[model samples]
Target: MSVDVITNTSPVIWLGRVLSGLAIAFLLLDAVMKLVPIQPVIDTMQALGFNSTTTLARGLGILLLGCTVLYAIPKTALVGALLLTGYLGGAIAIQLRAGNPLFSHILFGGYIGIFLWAGLLMRNNQARALLFP
Candidate 1:
């Protein structure tokens, strides 16, 4: 005779998945907007004192896309998170330099960073072990 066993996933894991998905979706949209160089994106970049050139926007978009892809992959997620942290840090700096609002503009990147890392920590055992242990 043989016995069968079933395992159940924790709700926390599901929450993590949802959070990760939200972060990914937002980032992907932002990247696409940058890549396409719409008027609003160009206007925002200029407001932030960036060059607002199509080439620069496309370059940033490509970089964001690569980092987001890495984060989406389980194998390279840690590295991707680290890279994204840096990217978001730069964004925060830019927002601050531009004298944007504290809660809305400057902290927006912080909010996203929290979601990214929190999702990773909750969903990834390796990440939790590395950080906690």
Candidate 2:
């Protein structure tokens, strides 16, 4: 019988981990900032036509934190990624409605989504196989 071996030391795996880590870090930071309801965050939310209430910010932060946590877990990463994609899509819509710059603001969520999926595809054999097959 042949044993299937997975090597974590591969450079490609390392690159994938790095990319995923960066996305996680950024998302965590964003969640924390919203949880804190910092002045700048509140100001930005108001500018985006969202309710500037601290309660709303905290609620959003909690949702984001939960999603990010799921994404950080290997088993639930796909579900988390899907949730994040939905969240990002909403963000993109909001930015577009606010007439934000296309590249810098409107498409920012797409950029993050790319990194998220790319990292997952590279590191997870199951994901790659599922997609490619």
Candidate 3:
């Protein structure tokens, strides 16, 4: 059997896919790290005033992973995006409360959020219509 691939492609779509892939990969890695709760992660959590509790970290990790999965699936992507937006907003608030750097720490979440939304906008017509129209 022959495979039917997306043939009518454009640069914007390609960029969207790439951005979505990047966000997914990064979020996946982050979730895994939190689940693992390695030494570095624990330290970072303590630095961020999270009490560095393994249970809490893993719970948060699982939640983030769930959000990422939702964002990755086409049917549930809108809900996933909305969830991730809130998650990223919380991250930004944490960094701000921790007195982290403006650009490197606090704004990092905003940057990733931009990529997530922009990628969705470029590749998904439904998302585009919801956002623009």
Identify the leading candidate in terms of lDDT. Answer: 1
Listed per candidate, the RMSD to the true structure in angstroms reads: 5.6, 3.8, 5.7
| Candidate with more favorable, higher lDDT: 1 or 2 | 1
User: lDDT of all the models against the reference?
Assistant: 0.89, 0.88, 0.88
Steric clash pairs (candidate 2): none
List, residue by residue over 3-79, the lDDT tens digit for candidate 3.
11231258778888889989999999999999999999999999999877999889999999999999999888889
lDDT of 2 by residue, 3-113 (tens): 114324488788888898999999999999999999999999999998789999999999999999998899898888899999999999999999999999999999999
Off by over 4 Å in 2: 1-9
Candidate 1 residue lDDT tens string, 1-133: 2111111247777887889889999999999999999999999999999878999999999999999999999989999999999999999999999999999999999999999998888788788778866
Clashes in predicted model 3: 0
> CA lDDT of 88 in candidate 2?
92
What is the RMSD of candidate 2? 3.8
Total backbone clashes of candidate 1, pairs 3 or more residues apart or in separate chains: 0
- The 10 consecutive residues of candidate 2 with the worst lDDT sum are 1-10
